[model samples]
Target: MTDLLHDARVSRGQFLRMMGGLAAAAFATACSTRPQTSTPSGGGQATTELKFIGVSDQKAPMDQLVAAYQKAKPSVRITASYAPTDQVQTSVRTQLGAGNAPDLHVVYPGSGSAMSMSQIAEAGLLADLSAQAWTRSIPEGFKPAFQLDGKTYIHSAGSSVIGAVYNKKAFEQAGVEAPPTTWSEFLSVCDRLKKAGLVPIALGAQTPWVTQLITYALVPSTVYAKDPTFDDKQLAGQTSFAQSGWREAMEMYLELQKRGFFNDNPNGTTFEQQTSMVATGKAAMAVQVSAVLPDFRKAASSPDDLSMFPLPGAGDAASVWIPAGVVVGLGAAAKGANVEEAKAFIDFLGKQENINAWAKAIAAIPLVQDASSTIDPAVESFLPFTKDRAVPFMDQRWPNAEVQPVHFAVIQELLAGESTIDEALRKMDEAYQK
Candidate 1:
């Protein structure tokens, strides 16, 4: 029957006979399809109302944008709700799946994570944003984060780089002269900090998401810098994480752990605690996404006490690559009753002025090419790499949702002294196949 289904000469009747019970059973459970209709691409009929849901961590900018959007388009009344990052990720997925999703909500970039654009889009939940005018301005490297199958589903106001956020005071205390520009120098700095009786890197392995940051920061140099086509090769079944530069990156992480470079009992530390360690000068540094620099500032005695530097994951400083991608971005629900209104708001949000203003308010790097917005000074060091040296987050190119969690779990196991680099990589390969 399987062979007949693929036979070129098989008649329709023969195909049906081969499919038999499977065909009838599928039809019996299938719901009737409803033709989808999209509102006019020209900012839809002066939307009267919009429902917006966003992460509370981004509330200030999101709220400000909503208010400004409402004033400019006074005909539309926008009501918004915000929650913690973790809660927003979970709730958005549940709501989108239940057909009760918000008219507009925040979605993570790329595939294989909770509330990620790829995951929701695969479920037929996101409104198509391919026609949005600003889509033309997005850089080619960044387009993949907000798009899937050449169709855009989310609109990122900007992007953020991941790197080592360090304490200048702690570095001085350890007698380190400057930020390292190579992997060996970085390890040496770590050794110096550890010898000075300081935690060189504060890690929060108890939070699974935190486990992926260092790997993401390192892999661009370890993997993509050498072979930019690594992900393409991976998709073609020509590569695997266990056998690629990813293994080198993950092994480096394990080496850092073995050398006593991280805070003790990392598995018990929370993200907030890890940030506080560096903010308070108890730790020399931490690998983190640039978006959270504000949280570290809040924990510090002086806002200027903390700053970020690009993590040089390769031995050759000139060849080092930086990790940059869209942070959480906005998405519209495909089947919402107010779909048109939501889309209008999205179009407005993508305007250069709006994108610039939103980027400034959140300390993000604006995505629109013409936007006259400045990046946070803390991340200015990363600007040089933005053009051609940036790589997307490693997991963003993952094949499915199962792979990320597996990567995180295995890393935690390695840090907990329960697994070896080989074991972790093997588990990752197994998950990648699924």
Candidate 2:
């Protein structure tokens, strides 16, 4: 898996093409029918049941697409459920190990998490999706996220950025007219928001995955913006989290907490509470991925009040970068009885219209776009930076699954004042080596 991951290096040009969208690839619009047992409903019509489990961010699009699929193929009925990242990672992975996983389940891009494509594919638990037409359209730079050993294993609609999802009303209330462009200005804005009696940042550190976003949002500027080859150097054992810009990023993360810029008792807050705080204008913003913009909008009285901006992680606006990576996606279980049926659903998701719908639902940049693709306006501010100023999510390039969970744990400890930056980075470095 390590050799395969190393082989998946993406050049700058290829990365640009990916963000810009690849040429339209032809896909099969005809749905295939398969033999199934007859059901009592619909006058003894055939019925095939497939179960899918995914993270909460996937629910909005999945609900819409699943309904479309069922309408197209009445014989197949999909039952889908959503859960938080930590829960899906733990329970679904256990199900995979036990060989009774759902027909389709959430799979993180690249290889840093237990449910990542490489890790799951390495275990031979993910069905090969290389034959799908959509796989042919995947941009070369993004192959690492969608494929392992040159075989596509997951189906994702597009990429998303991690930024500050802020409430316009809250910002107005704080007398802040615009989003900050530099680190110092960001701090000043936070101070103003805090003084105005609003939580400058709503952080849900108790939810493990939520703990990593602030650092992920900051590291691109502190690390990659200075040395684009930092991941390579770390993989070569020439550098580490402790010795690189990771230290600076960690310090910055802690600095936000130290300034009381985050909501009180962040370590006890859940992602739901954090989303509510920002959506309803109780807080100015939350550092989060663009993929969850729908959730924030759903919780708000007026969705238009929510918009996103790149979280400035550097003193210089030009040096600041953002984390843009493939959104969490689903894969068919290789060992499942309904593997073919599940793969069909993934194939349905690959169609252009379906991809557009999914991307629009999550406010992501479509993996492959055409005239029909509509990017969410909230993320328009981050587009100029996508060409050269963005890096894939840090975990996507990690050598093992251990590093990410360790990252989540250390951040929680730091937020709770139970750990120091040095200690946190040390633990992360140790996990990376493992």
Candidate 3:
């Protein structure tokens, strides 16, 4: 039967034999049709096939790269599974409960995601992938976000900046001859743009992550820079999501929202759709990250139409490094059948060439030290600001998970007129109380 499965003529027939016991109609046979005795690609004997599970947001490049890998090794079969970023853990948890899960998926180290994986890791449901060469590429400051007791669980090729991207031309048009380097000047510029018949700022609260971007911009201004001992205080609970200057920040966010700056129905817009608002000049700027710039570049009539400036709260460039955000999460089911092969796939991914390709494809900065290799040219103009002073995105570094979500909820409530600034602050404080 194994030999027959390897035979081209009997491939379909063998699939039926293997899957018939699991289901009826054999139509699902095609789903499991790969030969069990297949040789590994790029080797003498195939080891195992890796099954990947994660968000489909980056699927295009993954597909292209995987196809190239397959061309180089016809024997290995690499299966990629995609789900919404929010759903990846839930899917894995469900499958774990059902005694079935992908060979490799996604997980984060703290709070919402890592908590779920921590149970499995404690139960030994995950495999140790720390030995992979890719682990070496992660920067020193960010290692904790992906690690559990010194073992790493996730790998992202690069990271994105969590700051503001403004239009150079918009400032010129609004009688603001120079980009403001102070928060007061920044708000004044927004008022100018709004008065000039342009939406002062663009936000996509409908997608939720947009709300996080707003918080990301505010984190540098409201927390990290203002508090002389911010990180220490935050870790000690002396400073919290609610106690900081966040109320002022939220008030300011609401003020902008009330002034009709963001898209009228931010909740109705997708990230891509909201990105268009900035790309086409519907809004003078967007509270976004480098992750969205690829979409912006693709949609822009002139890629030059978009450029970035760090949010003004840092007092100066030297003090403002905390606004960079990174996507950190673990790989999938450790005990799944594809562990060895999946590790192989990840190893191939960490190679500088592939990592560089992935970073440039998304217009993000490199996770590895050697960034000069392939930074996207259109976005490269923004790199100098990131150069000596780089910081992990605020959300990733935060110990308490609720802070980010509470931020989005409070902002939405503020926008809906459901809560006053005082109430929002109290709600925020209560949220941090947990």
- Best candidate per TM-score, number? 1
Q: Which of the numbered candidates is closest to the native, going by highest lDDT?
A: 2
Model 2: lDDT equals 0.91
Residue 330 in model 2: shift from native, Å? Answer: 1.0
Task: Sort all candidates by lDDT, best to worst.
Answer: 2, 1, 3
* Pairs clashing within candidate 2: none
lDDT of 2 at 167: 99
Write down the TM-score of every candidate.
0.86, 0.86, 0.80
Which ten-residue region of model 3 has the weakest summed lDDT?
A: 109-118
The per-prediction CA RMSD against the true structure, in angstroms, equals 12.1, 16.3, 8.8
Task: Give lDDT tens digits, candidate 3, residues 260-341.
Answer: 7677877667787777877887788887787767777677788787777666654454555436655543465666766776
List the global CA lDDT of all models.
0.86, 0.91, 0.67
Q: Model 2, which residues run further than 4 Å from truth?
A: 1-46
Q: Residue 241 deviation, candidate 3, in Å?
A: 2.3
| lDDT head-to-head 2 vs 3, winner | 2
